[model samples]
Target chain A: MRIWDPSIETLDRVSLRQLQLTRLRETIDRAYHHVPCYRSKFDELGLGPGDFRNLEDLRRFPFTTKEDLRLNYPYGMFAVPMKEVVRIHSSSGTTGKPTVVGYTKKDLESWAQLVSRFMTAAGVTDEDIVHIAFGYGLFTGAFGLHYGAERIGASVIPMSSGNTDKQIMIMQDYRSSALVCTPSYALTIADRMEKTGIDPATLALKVGLFGAEPWSEEMRRELETRLGIVATDNYGLSEIMGPGVAGDCLERCGMHIAEDHFIAEIIDPETLESLPFGEWGELVLTTISKEALPMIRYRTRDITRLHPEPCRCGRTHVRMEKTRGRSDDMLIIKGVNVFPTQVEEILFQAEGCEPHYQLIVDRQDNVDSLTVEVEVNDQIFFDEMKLQRIFIQQLEKKLATGLGVGVRVKLVEPSSIPRFEGKATRVIDRRSR
Target chain B: MKVEQISIFIENKSGRLAEVSRVLGEAKVNIRALSLADTSDFGILRLIVDRTDEARKVLQAHNFTVNKTEVVAVEVPDRPAGLAEILQILDDVQINVEYMYAFVERCSGNAVIIFRFDNVDEAIAALLGRGVNVLKGEQVYEL
Candidate 1:
């Protein structure tokens, strides 16, 4: 397989470490000088950019958390001024308040390059037609893959999410070869195709790039077999740079991080102590080449280990395992990241709904289905059958649109859900892990 | 006039039907006519009950989703082509029947058919205009 940017992707260990150190120092100095959040953090740890003698010094610095971004709100953590920042993206905030991120013109250019490297490594080329199904708007998944696919000179069908039947028709008529979407959504499409009697093998799809939610090896096999494509996984978060952060090569090993732009570290979640290579722990990332919002040892709550050994595909960067689970209470159903608290918040927003709700996630026919059993108020108990059915449909639409995931809402009777005295058990994930 | 039918939402599990019966039996609410429509996950238990409000209240108290639906009871000839004659009237008037089930007992040698219609009032008017026997809520609950 051909490697993209071999000089950077397969750099020698000694030279790669030196480049990482230089970029790290530059990021620290930028964050400390311009962003007060990072300055205060560095001061709180009694450290400075000059204090970094080597890569190991990243441990002495205080870790930045998602709470910090929320506290900073919009643009408070940006290293550059708003005038210089040409693009902006914010989290979906399926919970409550969203975290905003900005990128300068240079940042966007660099982001596209990083993303292009991954698409190339996964065997996508100018001849391939990439169909991006990730939803557009404030979410970064679509735009990230869009720019990268364009950068590689590939024909892009920017068919952003939903419209399942139309998507299949375009995929067939346009003869698109690459599919970029969430793993769960890929399975959903495959299942829909089978139900419609559309032979997936007759399609021109050759490669699949899936991410944004945790998936299993079993799911990868299912997608590959049903979609007739070579499935690959990529990793990224909007708080950092999105989709280009890391991706798998043709070898189908772990995803290779773009070491030149970001530093990857794993730490034991309980003690916050850094763990050695090949050990399972929480993945921590630091943006070493960001121009707008350079993160300094940002804590990504995803739990996984890293393999630093050289990949068979000839890439020298560290590879992180597919995120198995989260140290926190985050549920990824049908490729949408959700928190149970978000479900409760939506439930409370709708009238005639009780505070009690149970989220049931089950995987059937290689796709994930989320069913929210919401307790209805006593007042709704006396509603006419027609009105009750309308109410249930309205609640279903509200939750699905709010969370950006198709949710099945069941109007259970009041007090049917068991009350909890302590930390409430809000989610019953039956997806078989 | 239309009859009040109690529809209970039930999970598809063993002993669930018996549990609904036990709850109603304890509450002394007699089920006059009943039918169940189910898929793999859940079932809808439709019943013509002697006491609509009481059955719904006791079922709700026992943590069952209960709703009162309006359905009409039509007495058809207890012979060949009886059900076909009723369907032909609905087809002629363009009145859609959502679902239908047979009552347990017969009235004057005629079979009682319970029907849920898209517009209960329109179906009742169309049935009565065609000289069809449209039973009232009180008579169907007793039968």
Candidate 2:
């Protein structure tokens, strides 16, 4: 197995913690002094950078939630000024505001390096052609993996997401070796190849680096068999540095967190208390080396357990199990994070639409589809069938535009959707994998 | 003369159409004429019933999305070009027929056709002016 940076990845526990302590202190100072959000948070707790005597003392600080990022809006959480920032990425929020993160020149360099570590561990080499299927732009998955592959001196074919037929065409013509995309998308490509009577064995694909959505071991096996490639899972989020935060090292036991750059913590989501190794809990990460945005104990909401035991592959960083599930009700459809509230917001704004609605998510033919079922009311109902269809289609268009993904709006009879007592069950996810 | 037509929205699933019919049947509503328009996802069941308001109220009570629309019923000449002549008369006056369906019962030995037009009043005026018999709401309901 290959390790991108041996000095950091395979550092001894004593030395790694020493490095983490030093970086943690520096990050704390930078965040407390520069970012107003962190500054006030530390001030409210009556703490400062000087109080950090050791790694354990770092827990006294407050945890930053996604709401904090929204509160700050675009650039309020950055420790550096806009002039020093070079790149920007954001995740779509439940409402209109997105959680944005910026990167300085050095930050971007470290990001690529971090990403390269995981891709390298997943068997991507300079001789291999890396085909990235994640869409580029505000979403960090594509650009993060793109730069990381480039850093490894790999020939990158930037085939951004969608156009599955074209993706297969490029894969065949370009003779690409490594496939980078969501696991479901890879399956979609496999389905396309099968329908077109193309054999997977004829392709040159050797490894697949799949992420951005939770997939199963069964799906991994299915993808491996159909695509004839070694499928591996990588984990990351935009709030932290994207894609390179952790990944499997061919061992496939768990994804090794880039502990040198991030300080990973498992905490009970309800009590906000830290959990022991091998216990399932919400993953919280504090950016120790990030320059533009120094995140302090950001709750990832991803539920997983950490394995502190050393792997046969020789990396010392703790390995996290594939995220069992999320601590929240956010749904990942086609790798895009969608909150039920986001769907509700759009439905509420639609005139004559009842507040009663449900979101049905199902994976059909390896592609995720969202169907928004809304209860029909007199205000929106039309006497003519043609007018009713047009109304429903207009609502579908509005939801698609608002959600950034295709959605089918289904009109149900009045009061058909069951009314719940307290928290409403708004989402019905039938995706088996 | 304008006639009342009830339209019910039904999801395209097994037993939905049967459920609508069962509800209307239990309410003792007499269906005079009927048409079904459908897409892959859903269907709209349109009916000219003996009592439009009562049928709609009953369907609504049963959680069906029911709507009432004003359509016109015209007596078509019972010959080969009976329906064509009525349509041509409306088209000559530039009246658009949104949709049309046939009634089961006939009036004065002529075929009674239910027509939903974009402009109901104008369609009735054009047909009545051409000596066409436009059945009143009561007459169609009785037939």
TM for every model, in the order presented, reads 0.76, 0.94
Off by over 4 Å in 2: A195-199
Give the 10-residue window scoring lowest on summed lDDT in candidate 1 chain A. A377-386
Clashing pairs in 2: none
TM-score of chain B of each: 0.98, 0.97
Q: Please give the CA lDDT of all the candidate structures.
A: 0.87, 0.91
Model 2 chain A weakest 10-residue run by lDDT: A346-355
On TM-score, the leading prediction is 2
Q: What is the interface RMSD of each candidate, in Å?
A: 4.4, 1.3
Docking class of 1: incorrect
Clash counts for the predictions, in order: 0, 0
TM-score of chain A of 2: 0.97
Clashing pairs in 1: none
Alpha-carbon error at A5 in model 1, in Å? 1.2
